[model samples]
Target: MSESSDLVMPDAADSERAAEAALRPRHLEDFVGQPVVREQLSLVLEAAISRGNVPDHVLLSGPPGLGKTTLSMIIANEVGGSLRLTSGPAIQKPGDLAAVLSSLQEGDILFIDEIHRLARTAEEMLYLAMEDFRVDVMVGKGPGATSIPLPLPPFTVVGATTRAGLLPAPLRDRFGFTGHLEYYDDDELATIVVRNAVKLGADLTQDAANEIASRSRGTPRIANRLLRRVQDWAQVKGNGKLDLSAARAALDVFEVDQRGLDRLDRAVLEAVCVRFGGGPVGLTTLAVSVGEEPETVESVAEPYLVREGFLVRTPRGRAATALTWQHLGMAPPEQSDTLFT
Candidate 1:
């Protein structure tokens, strides 16, 4: 069992979001990691500035907490444009999206996070808007409906999605540039932790930063969140300094393992290794066993587990790897072919 509750999830809560906002780098140069993305984006912004025109629409695709939102905000800042934030789930209807688009000024940026989830109608409306800078707004319903074309000011759409493959080809084609962000490496994550810790007023030592980074699962958001938790521990229990000892103690208190597994992560592994006899269990069954939604299991826990070689998706279902049993401190069952079924 994990030493703490699932409420101590890696997902940023409101407070953590406030910390993230404050810690976000305003310029591309200040942003750490994703060197390839940063360089390409810099060229795009520079070319637009030289031409004295709004840059082309950008699509940023990556896993959650990889700085897509930060990049979008940076794009607006570099271009000297105001950013209007919205999400695919927010635009329930075409009118909802139209309302947002109509409000944009020349040089303004509309950042749509989770854009792959946009409704079909909203997506079609966006197709026209992106290419022609106009939308045919339907004013009436039924046979009396009228398509009144509304010309929008020239602006840029920065779409961020965790599932870029889910985007339709037509919609994907509309974007001028797509920057796929990769996970941060250990050294890069350590730098990010050290830099952000200073902004948060925590006296984090280099070794402590490295410790946090090693356990961060190559994600900056988790690194910062853990640092904040360590900061809390240091201020209250330790001598108000984030050193190696304080870092390890704080992480233990928060129930984040050395590999960055939290309560939810452990739950999935335990379900597979213990209850299901090392799995080949269906996703729904696995989710039910862990008392979490299927989406939570598939999206939140499955990715990292599979990526780290602890879980594998088989035709039969999800099976546990040898590493999973070892991670759970359980004896590996007999080498059975069924485990791979």
Candidate 2:
């Protein structure tokens, strides 16, 4: 059996990296969608500046490519503070966190990506650092090791995570403001594409931009990537202008269908409807069957599948809906209930 025969989740770090590349908004104004978050973040920054103090810890939770890291940088810029970038996995021990916290200048911003993956010990250290600008360091050797309290510069912690549920309640409560980022709307994504095209000196027409946006999986990063690719195709195939036909041809070559089903997505449904007989199949078995990592199945494939009504999650596992069968060019099982119906 292939290694992916067992369910495996894609590496969270890898997903973060891809999302970061495609979607990290260059500025607060360019960050598309998430209106409520944008408004609230503005208020938070205003409050902090009015008082001339570091704002409360910010917790940003959302799916990948939603501009969490970009927002963190925006916050730092707005607050007139330098930002220190780190990740949960980077702070493996309390001492690692201590070093970061201790080095911060007053009113600095420390952005920790993937905060949910923080080591437990480091999480404990953060409580004190967040509440009080202090780090407790152990002094001396085994015979008389003593905890020494070290003062820290007043700084804001911007915590970004795709999995907020994994954060400890105590750590969660430490954040004074929490921002939940939502996926981009089609219009917002189109706007983002237009904005990026303007920056990149690409000739993207409105209809062409909209067409690419519609298939962007509601992600700015994907929209930007698609625009660049289509720009290349347009320059080579058509004129420099990315018109509708050029955009379509580019998407076709990229394997992103009109409905945005890539090879991985199609492979998922095919495995479900054809192999599992339209599943009520366990996740592990399905993952193993697909030769994909379970985590990838859960995070990437399942989100889109469920969103499109092609799959359903249940206590037993995942079941392919009638939509899945139809999409996969198969007839639904006679005995199965229509998941959408």
Q: Which candidate achieves the best lDDT against the true structure?
A: 1
What range of 10 consecutive residues in model 2 has the weakest lDDT sum?
1-10
User: TM-score per candidate, in order?
Assistant: 0.93, 0.89
Q: What tens digits encode model 1's per-residue C-alpha lDDT throughout 1-341?
A: 36464456545476667777999999999999898999999999999999999999999999999999999999999999999999999998998999999999999999999999999989999999999999998888999999999999999999999998999999999999999999999999999999999898889999999999999999988998899999999999999999999999999999999898999999999988888888789999999999999999999999999999989999988888888877888886676543543
Which ranges in model 1 have alpha carbons more than 4 Å from their true place? 1-17, 338-341
Per-prediction backbone clash count: 0, 13
What TM-score quantifies how close candidate 2 is to the native fold? 0.89
Candidate 1, number of clashes: 0
* Candidate 1 TM-score to native: 0.93
RMSD of 1: 5.0
The CA-based lDDT of model 1 is what?
0.92
Candidate 2 segments whose C-alpha is farther than 4 A from its true place: 1-27, 335-341
RMSD of every candidate to native, in Å, equals 5.0, 6.0
